[model samples]
Target chain A: MAEAVDVAGLVDRARDGEPRAVARLISLVERGSTALPEVAAALAPHTGNALVVGITGAPGVGKSTSTNALVRAYRAEGKRVAVIAVDPSSPFSGGALLGDRVRMGDHATDPGVFIRSMATRGHLGGLSWATPQALRVLDAVGFDVVLVETVGVGQSEVEVVALADTTLVLLAPGMGDGIQAAKAGILEIADVFVVNKADRDGADQTARDLKYMISLGRRDRSGPSWRAPVVKTVAARAEGLDRVVAAIDEHRAWMTEHGELAGRRLRRAAAEIEAIAVERVRTRFPAADELAARVVEGELDPFTAAEKLISGSLGE
Target chain B: MAEAVDVAGLVDRARDGEPRAVARLISLVERGSTALPEVAAALAPHTGNALVVGITGAPGVGKSTSTNALVRAYRAEGKRVAVIAVDPSSPFSGGALLGDRVRMGDHATDPGVFIRSMATRGHLGGLSWATPQALRVLDAVGFDVVLVETVGVGQSEVEVVALADTTLVLLAPGMGDGIQAAKAGILEIADVFVVNKADRDGADQTARDLKYMISLGRRDRSGPSWRAPVVKTVAARAEGLDRVVAAIDEHRAWMTEHGELAGRRLRRAAAEIEAIAVERVRTRFPAADELAARVVEGELDPFTAAEKLISGSLGE
Candidate 1:
């Protein structure tokens, strides 16, 4: 595959503000090919400089719209922004539809904002296997703010977003089952919550319910201390965009004050490393087709078969 | 923690139909501790015998009621049934609410029926990492049929159900987002479809919509053509369960006739082993807390740190 893009060269070009090199680096990461190790090493020194924000919620909650608004608000302040919209990969198609761009049409022509759609690509985790590598490339390209918008809600998405410096969970009014939103477990991870479509009748009620739910947090100190601030927004109308941006900024400032920003970044790094290790084992094992065939033939017990494959490669 | 139960002893007892051993084995699987390797090995040969039926739907769609009715229907036919209800691990408590049991009260006194609830327990995939192992235990205990009930609709749950021999995607009438369900990509995986609460208004429209969707599939010329049967069920009234069971049986007959059973089982086994390999790597990696601290200190970049960890333990 053209010897996979030269890692050092790509990193150098990305650091010199070449968007093409940044795109190439992300492509290598997304593939999870052999060039990943080299690419990762090349971009190692340039990362840890960008402020990463994670946006997640249930499907059809208007997260893409809220993300687009957030991006525009940041760009309005003259800051370069990078948006990574993570789309779920279709197993049958082996590709993501990536309809997120349809919602962020305004940012497409803005030179200061870079938007890329990433597919999970059969990765178990909600984020793509190459996400960390891609983030490094974006960081190297000097994006002051990097926002990761996850495609769906699940434990994997939660874990991926936990890597972000600030995580915002978007919930829409009149979803009918407000409890369903809570059941998605997004409430626990959100540093800031937004009730989009605030013009709806139940917008205030949803905010109240979310606040009540947040007050039920049992782990840390209670009341408003561990509560996520609920912001009301009409993303389509761009109303309350300033308040949403201010809340984000306030959360960032709080993290910095509490020294949680550095801690969160560190955890994110550790999680990235752990994910990479797991990915290595997955690649070294026999292909799924081969293993399936063996299991079907009764030639190997799945447990023993898996053990042999894993231990033979990585050792228990 | 307590010398992790002797795998050989547990396997022997489970094979002899000891209830305690079966329960213990399932607990081991649910915890997904280091003891999993031994447990998986001991139970490996016992699997590939039970027919796995996976049931999934949106929450409050009466999935639990339908599952209960199915169990009752199967038991009435003199078939021994085992149900494994998968739920989200409570992030706040780490304990599963195990609400499925409350809906399955009728089976409480049935000696031939065994029901267990499994929490996702942070497994990257929607399934409990120990799912295959639990199934093996149930199979060894001589359950004629095993039913896997997934918690709510999402990618992970849908995927876990896809691993089953026959996947039944449940739906309710008046589901405001019937179209959203279609877009969620659930339609493609279902082998048998059930529209629960069929007495409700708009039920026919939902059924018609689903039938039209299924009709879009290309016809197969080889073997018995499998069409996803749409069954209407009012589970509270114990209505239409027979048709659902018949559809499952028909699917099984078709699978047996076409020699697809062995292939499907093999695929499931292969996936189980692949998951094990990935889990092993996760366990062997450094603790997340320590790595996170290093990243926070800026002593190492996430990429370089991850590369070092993976290369050191998992690479040649």
Candidate 2:
């Protein structure tokens, strides 16, 4: 097993600008195995540098097209970009079609642009259990900007994107489900909105409706300091992408200036760490399976089970 | 405090056809409190009798309208029905709008009809945590049929609907996001498909496309036995609702003949018990919090933590 992987050495190689090492590290994290702890420990010191952006919307809203456009815009500014595409599993085959990679074909040969597609694999969220680790690997590998594109507007997608530094919600004109999106959890998490295919007839109306829906939730006092902007875009043609990039930059700057960026990152990091800890306890303890069986059999309650499990683990 | 709610007594009263007791019992189950073990045990023997039909689609696909039509149809057949309309939490206030109840106003006073509106309440699935409990309560309370209508097409919603004995996916004409729905995990779990708003243009094409997609997934050499019928309805006018109900009845008959109905009900009961068990652990266990804190501190890993927690509980 290669002596359980030299996590520290791999991290060092990745930090030294070795692309293969970086890729390998990400693969390890994505596997989310027992060795993940060592890899995460090694990569932890190098993270907290990349600006993570989340792009999401209903499918066929041209999310990939918009992502490609945004990547091009960032590349034009001489910035290194990493794109993570979360793909859905094939219901028939239970494997990913890898359609997301094909959608972003233009970046296939671009060295400055790195693309990876992930599958949910039965994770409750539209992300893999190892997504956070993969992100850390990407960060340690020195990507200045990271873009996470969720496959669709499911609740898990929204929750996953909420962990990003800036979340951009993409919508197509004439979806007529704008209010539905707002009603669902997507509207609350977006820091910026893009009405892709703005050339369509109802684009203006959709924008107006979205703005109105947003204003309903704007308390004007206790929420975030900035208001989410609705940007119009023709992503395929790359029109209005500069404005999108500019909006993202402005949001980043505002977050940084207002201290919200660091605060949010801290919270996200805390959540990440907490999730990791719970996962570890579950993996290391043999009694966890028995407890689950008891709960399943209705012989023991879940809450009491949880308490006993934790107490035992802490040697109480 | 009211003697801490005599869970067994409440379950008995609900089973004896007391509406107030049924409602209160469902509330307890929905809350997923530490005391749920007692409540679940009391109700376990009384459940596994009702037909659970889950209806889901994007908002404005007329899911509510279709539900109303179905309710009217089933009621006309002298079948006692329970409708559980699961709505999303309001983006502005983090509260449920209860819009589904308003849309279902006609059944407000019908003695044979039970209408309940549930909020997503931060649950990832579109269905509320209390849904299974509510369904069980209804089943035990003597309702022969239960219908669950989810507000949107989310993975959670799909998962919730998948728990139902029959799942009907409502699609509206001219939505233009059918492929997107397919990608978002809607196409796989559908037991029956309804192309609502058949009066609208392009209904035929949409139906054709949906049929083709269904055909793509049918791999069973015995041919799935039950062909998912594509019923076209204009629910606003109560058009073709009879056909929808007929389709549901046909599915029920097929399941009964194949012994699938009993098996499905057994599975649903098991699932309900499993959910209740997990909820109990979550409620009684403080370890989740501790593990979460460790994850935040980067001192542990998530997967391992989850496994450890589960195993520890098993030992209890």
Number of the top DockQ candidate: 1
- C-alpha local distance difference test of each model: 0.74, 0.72
Residue A248 lDDT in model 1?
81
Query: Against the hidden reference, what TM-scores do the models get?
Result: 0.70, 0.61
Task: List, in order, the clash count of every candidate structure.
Answer: 0, 47
TM-score of 2: 0.61
lDDT tens per residue, model 1, A1-316? 4354667777877777677777777777676656766666665656677888889877877887888888889988988899888776653463443464575478766767888877765644436456766787787678999998887777647656766888888888877334665686767788888898899898988998888777666457744344578899999888888998888888888888877777677667767777765665566555655765665454555656666666553222
- lDDT leader: 1
Q: What tens-digit string does per-residue lDDT give for candidate 2 at A1-316?
A: 3338878788888887676787787676666545776776666556678889988888799988888899999999998888877766632453343564475478766777777777766442325356777787888678899998888667557556657999998888877555876777667888898999999999999999888888886866695568889999999899999999989999999998998887676666545644554444444456666655554444544444555555554232
Off by over 4 Å in 2: A1-3, A53-128, A141-160, A167-224, A227-253, A270-316, B1-3, B30-34, B53-126, B141-160, B166-224, B228-250, B266-316
Provide the TM-score of chain B versus the true chain B for each model in turn: 0.83, 0.82
- State residue B70's C-alpha deviation in candidate 1, in Å: 5.6
